[model samples]
Target: MERLNGYKHLILGNHDRGHSLAWWLNVGFDEVSEHPIIYKNFFFLSHEPMYMNKHMPYVNVHGHIHGQKYAGVNYFNVCVEHWDYTPLTFEQIRDAVVPSEEQA
Candidate 1:
């Protein structure tokens, strides 16, 4: 994290071993949450592809959908399999904003 000079946030998964938000914060994340974390009107970051009301005004950027990415407009899968074992990049997220696209 120091190398990147970036703010890292965490959304704990169902099986995550980390128990305290403060612990994760001390470990380097700028923020941590057990539920989806909303950013601007464009991002909803989460561990699982949370079941939100369709009326939600933001998009979900999530993991836990291990094999296949969801084929929907309101959610973006950051799961490794969706990205060929690599982390999703900012460019990838921008590309994925298109309703019919996913790869980056």
Candidate 2:
């Protein structure tokens, strides 16, 4: 993997478990997690899609499904295939999901 300029956090996926946590850190990930983590009390970041209902307050941003999308308004697939092979900023994601008036 190419070295990225900002803080790199990795949420381990099924394939990522083949290596040790230290190995991932050495490869340039600043932080590593074995499970889903909540960000800003609304975005649930994870490697795989977590179950969500329409009434749920949090939006799940995940990637394990690749080209396929999880069926829910609260699910955002960060898979490269969905974004023309480019990563998106948190602001872009936030704006796409939450209206500016609703954002804090």
Root-mean-square deviation of every model: 4.2, 1.7
Candidates' C-alpha lDDT: 0.74, 0.88
Evaluated with TM-score, which candidate comes out highest? 2
lDDT of 1 by residue, 1-104 (tens): 56545567778887765477877777788878777777766687888776667787767888888878776777888888877776676556856575444332
In model 1, state the lDDT of residue 40. 64
Tens digits of lDDT, candidate 2, 1-104: 56456778999999999999999999989899999999988899999899888877899999998758766778888988888988788889888888788977
TM-score of each: 0.71, 0.89
Best by lDDT: 2
- Give the range where candidate 1 is weakest over 10 consecutive residues by summed lDDT: 95-104
Error of 2 at 60 (Å): 0.4
Superposed model 2: Cα runs more than 4 Å off: none
